[model samples]
Target: MPEINSRQKTAIAAGQKVLNSVNGTPKCLVFTSPAAAAWAQNDTLAAGQKIPAGSRILSNCAVSCGALGASVTFDLGLRHFVTGAEVDLDGIASNVASATAGTYAANNGVLVAGGVDSVTTVDTEPVLTLEAANPTDDIQIRVEIWYLPPG
Candidate 1:
């Protein structure tokens, strides 16, 4: 007689197989500017980090102004260090005074390709620009990027 596996065992094996099909894990990259002076300035968050092809990226941003009645704008994106061509990720325009936050993701979680990925050998990083209009006040901006690697 041949031995048979239980129903519970069969289900557990199937679940494991499904999980194994999904490769890589979710990772996060963060960029912050403390005491950013009024006016326009650019900051680097992560630099020269290896990101495999076919990976997806998402970003979130938060800003706080030192004084009221001051408007701030921020642009976040990925920049290729060698080519200097930026892939725009998200933008926060004229945020309210005090504190505000925003979240952004790629179009339907599309994978990174074309020039966004490293053409040579090294990896790329995220860049953020903050622009403030009027008054002399310090602003703080924080950006977070979430990505999933390919299998």
Candidate 2:
């Protein structure tokens, strides 16, 4: 077997940190609807991993308008089931003028504890919420969250 170089060794160490949960990991929540109304929750994280306070949440939203002259406005964020408080990540508004297809995309990030560096006790398994103005319109939303485990 060949010997590993210094740079390769460093890369291996970084990967190990992520595998050990020292570094943050990526989690994805996807919601799709032909016509969606009302607030909906995405699938929760796996049993071992829970979102803690001060964890950074990155959001990306995409919307596809089906009908001409149709529009949809929606907010995507994390909602703490216990407190019933939500943290908004991104809002997407799209309008289709003509019969041609149209799409909207946006990106943003937010810390779980409202910019506070310290962790809060209320932090728990967070569910992604999609609040839509026009839920009857065709749209699909996907939110990705990267977070470090809470100590």
Candidate 3:
């Protein structure tokens, strides 16, 4: 699975810390398809990381991508960070498609201790799966997750 990701910019880090008050930080996963037929490369991004046990999701998960073409949909999920087990297939969102270029998000309010399952017994990693048609232009996808540590 692809573990390469970026941390949210510092501009929001302080605000996020204040909101969670538990050392919450943001995780941004990105995938870029430089040309047609490259989207299939997403298979390599399956089972990416989410969070550690005892962590909490402090904000709604956000996904942004352009409308490469029609019938492009996505599945954002979370799996056990340590065990690499499937946790929530749609932990972020499901059937996310946009007819026009725009952003899509899932209103998954604050996740209790231990992340989405609230078990606090497992870790997590954000997984991104997409269904798309070949587009002549390049495209990129980004996943944003706000979560606190396993305190």
Candidate 4:
């Protein structure tokens, strides 16, 4: 599925526009970051927008921002792109803000890696992180990404 690019691989880079494998359907990751938290710290990995190990994190992605006041702003990033430490701080989304009450879109310039944007090599959980300076109380959001599970 990666025939058009120069850095193509043999494992196949699945996508909606490109060839979609049977297990390469779009997977939605929804997470909510409450107030006073710069990032998403879920009690369990299943609670947030956590991507499974050996998954292909294709391009088609989105994030919905909840009420966080007009002056509120945040950055949507990734955590544990590598195991143990938090990497790719602003890899998922960056320089995004929120409204008092409505849905907003997130900006993801370089997710995982710029070339293909797939989390194929890593075997750790990749969770979406909503970072803010003073994250207004009761802020919420949902991040959606289309990915292919490890085959």
Q: What are the per-residue Cα lDDT tens digits for candidate 2 across 49-71?
A: 24666444443344343432223
> Which one wins on lDDT?
3
* Error of model 1, residue 2, in angstroms: 39
Q: What does candidate 3's lDDT look like per residue over 14-121, in tens digits?
A: 454322324445444444333344554234245355466666555466766676467766666677777667777555666666435677774442243225444234
RMSD of each: 9.7, 9.3, 11.4, 6.6
The better candidate by lDDT, 1 or 4, is: 4
Better of 3 and 4 by lDDT: 3
- lDDT (Cα, 0-100) at 53 in candidate 1: 43
Top-scoring candidate (TM-score) = 3
In angstroms, the error of model 2 at 125 is: 6.4
- TM-score per prediction, in order, is 0.47, 0.40, 0.59, 0.58
Off by over 4 Å in 4: 1-23, 34-50, 81-84, 112-117, 126-133
Best-first order by TM-score: 3, 4, 1, 2
Which residue pairs overlap in candidate 1's backbone?
A: none
16-127: candidate 1 lDDT, tens digit per residue: 4322113347776665555555444333334344444445553222333333224544445555555656544332222223324344322221123332321212245666
Error of 1 at 29 (Å): 0.4
Those runs of model 2 whose alpha carbons end farther than 4 Å from true positions after fitting are: 1-22, 31-50, 59-69, 89-106, 109-121, 124-133, 137-148
Residue pairs in steric clash, candidate 3?
49-125, 49-126, 50-124, 50-125, 51-124, 81-123, 81-124
Worst lDDT 10-window in candidate 3: 107-116
The true-versus-predicted C-alpha distance at residue 75 of model 1, in Å, is 1.8
